[model samples]
Target: MDYALKESSTKFETILGTALKVPGVRVDREQFLLQTLGSKIKDGNIVNLAIETDPVTAGIPIDKLDKIANSLIKKRTTNTSMLSFAAGMPGGVTMAATIPADTLQFFGTAIKLAQELVYLYGYGEIGNANQLDEDIRRELTLYLGVMLGVEKSAAALRVLSTNISKQVVKRTSRRALSKTTLYPIVKKIGAIVGVKVTKASFAKNVSKAVPIVGGIVSGGTSYLSMKHMGHRLSETLSESIYYTDADYEKDFKEVCNEVVDVEFN
Candidate 1:
């Protein structure tokens, strides 16, 4: 074992083992610390049993133990957050923005997870990209029904991030993921339907919502609501219908007729 590697691991074991020796935290003997921080291999061989950081030897000067002690004391003292020292302005806006976009991406995971499931089931059955969305929404609502009121933050974040990633995948180019095109589609749906529609919802419902309508509203709402919204919008505006088969021509014309002849009576 490399000298540095062995030394660091020993120090880490001492610190952590000491902490876990307290009641309520059982340390796994097999996994120990290496599982969290993968095995370190050097020169084509496993060099150390574990690796870690130790404050004692990290920046100590061997010649002057007294100076080294003072340096360690200063390092620890200066490392406290503003909130601990005396909260005032706190960290700057740039510090907040510096957080990775991938980290914040969890906010939309629910949509992403839905998309992945749709892709797994069969995107071809959903028709175009829009129809695929309905399928995703239909399935997602069913899944979320089980987790509606769960208060676990980590679980919620994972679900939401997966959902968002799935939504972004569709309408994204074959070569690259891009939400730019999908956002406009959402805006259009929001405008015609008089509700805030999102790419995630589109991905969710496109498969299950018939040719155009979907479960953007309540999970229990009849399919008629989605079809009606699509029917009205189709009549109000000139649109293009892209389908896997020319067979949909009849269905398209029927939808148009339904919109034109619509009556409350």
Candidate 2:
């Protein structure tokens, strides 16, 4: 992939953002686990993120970053409400068991990662699912084609699609168990869009698959919007810890965006 650096960075952030989604104060313990003792999660892989982005274009401007960060804080507070209705949990035990201390750490990391991504790719309306999809696809295409190259574009799109799709599943599944109901619809819509955008080699498959996918995408988008809102919250909180924007200023140790532009073995 020509955009090997960019792809590597994207994956890095996705993994890392999960860690960074927490508040700074909470990150200390997990940071120690990740960086010092080197904690490993489900697999042998250390549950830490390594991310890199261009300083000039990768970090959103301070004002916009502040707006984004603040929004995320609000969303986190709101997401807490979901816990009230969480049938899955018995009580304090569920929150304690399901919501790990490390989640806060990941939340903080997720925020910083969002900052870099929003900096590189502008934020879009959370209300409009189609718009979000288009925005993501457009950005991925440009970033891959212009900055990275063809192979990278495909890879980036796949990654972006997969990531967004995961969010869609996460968000929507919370409300309704069967997002599969949307598959046929998304697949049809996907065909319409695919016919125009897809190249010959992959066009037929895309045409067949997209509407079913697109429909599910449409239905699941509400949750995706919430996830984006959560992401925005994470970013906002992380930035507040760093930059002293009057709108979102906070007292904490600032972490600079570190660049890690190497291929993972």
CA lDDT, every prediction? 0.26, 0.30
Q: For model 1, how big is the CA root-mean-square deviation? A: 27.1
Candidate 2: global Cα-lDDT? 0.30
Top candidate by lDDT: 2
lDDT by residue (1-265, candidate 1, tens digit) is 3344344334322322232233422323223223322322222112122222211122222233233323322322232211111211122122123221111121122222222222221121222345454333322332222122212211212222223222122332222213342222222222222111233223334433342222222222222222232222221111111221232334334333333332211
Error of 2 at 255 (Å): 15
- TM-score, candidate number 1: 0.18
Estimate the TM-score of every prediction. 0.18, 0.20
List, residue by residue over 62-165, the lDDT tens digit for candidate 2. Answer: 46435543544345434433432232122222223323322223233333333334332223222134555434434323222312122222222222322231
